[model samples]
Target: MKTKITNLQPGMIVGEDIYNLKNSLNLKKGQKLDRDMIDLILKSDITEIEIMDSNASIGFIQKTFEELPNIIDETIYNKWIDSISDLFHHFTKEEIYVSLNNITEEIYKSLNVKEYFVLNFINSFGNDSLTYHSLNTAIIVSIIAKKIEIPYIMYKQTVKFSLIHDIGYAMLDDRVINDFDSDDKNALIHNIVAYKKLQDLKATLNHEILESILYHHERYDGKGKFHLKGEKIPPLVRITQVADAYTSLTELGYTPYQALSWILKKCGFIFDPYYVGLLYEITGYYPTGTKVKLSDGSIGIVLRRNEIEFFPEVLVNNEPVKTGPDSNVYIKEVIE
Candidate 1:
């Protein structure tokens, strides 16, 4: 049955999950809600209500998930993942030649004014495609920077650097570029080439920031691109490396949980320990879209974020779970 807020009552059944007026829907969760108390809502007009069909809607969603396009397909999208990734790709490759003067003038102005951008890429769309890859890298870097609450200027420039960082890949043939090992020494050559090209354009960038894009591949264990670590590696560079890997993996097929877990598990080995800790906290352990089981044995679709990494806003039996991090009630297990 379709869930309609207006038609709902405290004790009535909506979906597989039970309806508890006190604990569910705009209040602390995990217990039954009091109908007498819920009468207070009667005073206010119900402007917007969230609801879902318990059966057909959920199964349809699950079944149709894999059939969805692997890459950004829609000209318009409101979903979080689709919008962010698309923004990253679209901005970086908007022009074949992102000159330093143009990058400085155009990107700086755009970043200064707008908090976000969009990507509508189609001509190039694979690992072999250099422009798409660069855009992907920039967007992931920007996302990490934003999550860390980087200052607007720094965040904007980080994105600009990321966009120009992989310009050298255009020199390689499609086949070779496509098949090139992401970890291969040849990756450094791309940075080197891009760096020189940027210099020719008279790139107006801080030295450290420029190196971030050029040497982001450098590993902590001396096995990576520049083989440099400690203070020698710029902070943004390290951030980009981790974000780059996460984005590429996530874009390929791994879910957000999978990508973040990989980063968390590789702490200090491939990623900076400090940043790894921060990223782990920011991204959390379980994937965002994962379905979970509550301590009370109720199942809910993971609704976006709750204050706690593990705690997420949930929709139980077609009604929203309103508990928060400090609340005694929370998700307890993966429900499959």
Candidate 2:
């Protein structure tokens, strides 16, 4: 069956090879379409393509899922939290690397259904423990990394670095760690301390990972701890900086919408505008798990982002409602 590009969905299978106007093959036959692939198709001049019939496409996706191994669940999520908490207590370089490696592998596996992963992560926010913050930052990095198609090895390195990005805080005094004033001299050294603490693991960890951890505080406009500015900072560090700040803000009681809004407001001055754009791409204007009220007086939780930025797919009264230009329903305001 031939379907217009606008009608394509994530689970549809290509029924034949698709060629561009220049007669170059774009999508191969039998390819199972994903959101990215659909977006690619939409961007190209191709307006229609042959896809498997609806019934067959549904069956194909169902069979593919049934054959695949189970991904993350609530039990595994708790275990990950416990493992991260344990890492803080044990505080060994070798153990930290091993645990983060395992956790990164599991996170990559869950990327196949990243929407669910993002939803689970947003809903899992808890008390402001170093453990929770570390894991939260890692999850956010994983989602961003996967969306941008960062290489597999580099993705693992970035996620691992995020998991231990603030390991230095564990070595600080209780007051310094708990209070956490950026302006305070004692609190500012945590980045340097973390860098030094990981020196012994240089043989095991990638150099980029270590460098990123050290410079994660570098602002895009040279106002950070070190005053390093703009392109002088490593790209990986810039990306991690945005994720770290957003996680910290949310931990400090900012709502998802508020945290993202703050980041957007600081773009170019505090964070790399390109990376900030990517964060918005992943989180949408109203990120997943945000409580909101609709124009029709119905309350709902944002389930996932849609092509439309302001109106996301929301779960209202046990049903998913996709709000967009064609729909009368829309999000009116975020609930506090």
Candidate 3:
């Protein structure tokens, strides 16, 4: 039975392969719909799904699912994932040097910025949080690059810097790294390790890029790993620092708004106030995919942020509501 997604009940079996608005298959046929799946579907902006009718033949539906490619495998999405994975794997190799510019151009040519953000929002809900965080930060770098209208060379360098900033963790034991908080001793060592590794690639790394990698964890107030204070931190490092923190917080189960709020609260002290402002322009008050509560106690998910800081297009009850001065609606808080 065709059913509105809101009407979907727990344990309701999916009748067919459920596709989102983009016609990308999300859930497969014969899978029993659960609360998490339903919520994910709604968050993805999928309005409806087919409910399984027990009286119908299961084989027919299964056959249909087999005929379609999984949404993650869709050409563009898969390519982006491959490119990110490839870059990540390169860090794991024993190569003494990597052509940073070559890798940057390869990824740049393979992705469309606008489409990449949408894909990131959709795919962030998946299991590979680490990879998504790296990619998300890189995408954010591009957005920041364009917004600041930096020279083309600097923009490319920023992308490369953000993407591999955490590659140092790749060399560490996952168990040990996860055992300690990011600010812990082991974690700090990994950052130093990654910085040194990049520094060793002197053939490709410049002083600026090397410092950004080494000092990305430096705080604006001087409480960071190396005790580098505000103004002492390099500009590129300051920008990537916020991007890394923002992505890490979100990956650790913080809602987008929750993460942004955390970043905002620490701005000027923990992060560069100027860069945080730039981040706000890119992510907005309510970033895309954040579930929010409105002034009137209604629940909604942010679709996109508009020119106004607080005002955004939200999906409330499956309807688009624009929040602005004209509308009485205001986002109360993020629904974590």
- Candidate topping TM-score: 2
Model 1 TM: 0.55
Query: CA lDDT of 54 in candidate 1?
Result: 27
- Pairs with backbone N, CA or C atoms under 3 Å apart (clashes), candidate 3: none
Off by over 4 Å in 2: 1-72, 93-96, 113-128, 173-181
Q: Write the per-residue lDDT of candidate 3 for residues 79-183, one digit (tens) a residue.
A: 555566565657644342344455466556654434313212323322233445566677666677766778878878788788777776566533121211243
Candidate 3 displacement at residue 136 in angstroms: 0.8
Give the alpha-carbon lDDT of every model: 0.48, 0.69, 0.63
Give each prediction's root-mean-square deviation over alpha carbons: 17.4, 20.4, 11.5
Worst 10 residues of 2 by lDDT: 59-68
lDDT of 2 by residue, 266-320 (tens): 8989889998998888878887667899998999877778876787888787688
Off by over 4 Å in 1: 1-140, 143-151, 173-188, 204-206, 295-301, 315-329
- Order the numbered candidates by lDDT, best leading: 2, 3, 1
After superposition, candidate 3 runs with Cα above 4 Å error: 1-77, 92-128, 175-183, 295-297, 325-336
Residue-level lDDT tens digits of model 1 in 1-336: 444445555422223322233332232111111243234334344422333332323111111123222223333211322333343344334332334234333333333212222121222222323444555565446545666777867776677676655545554322122211243344547667656645543434557655775776676666665668765777776666665665544433344555566676766777777766655554455544456788778886554454565666666776667445455667787643
Best by lDDT: 2
- Candidate 3: give its CA RMSD in angstroms: 11.5
lDDT of 3 at 100: 45
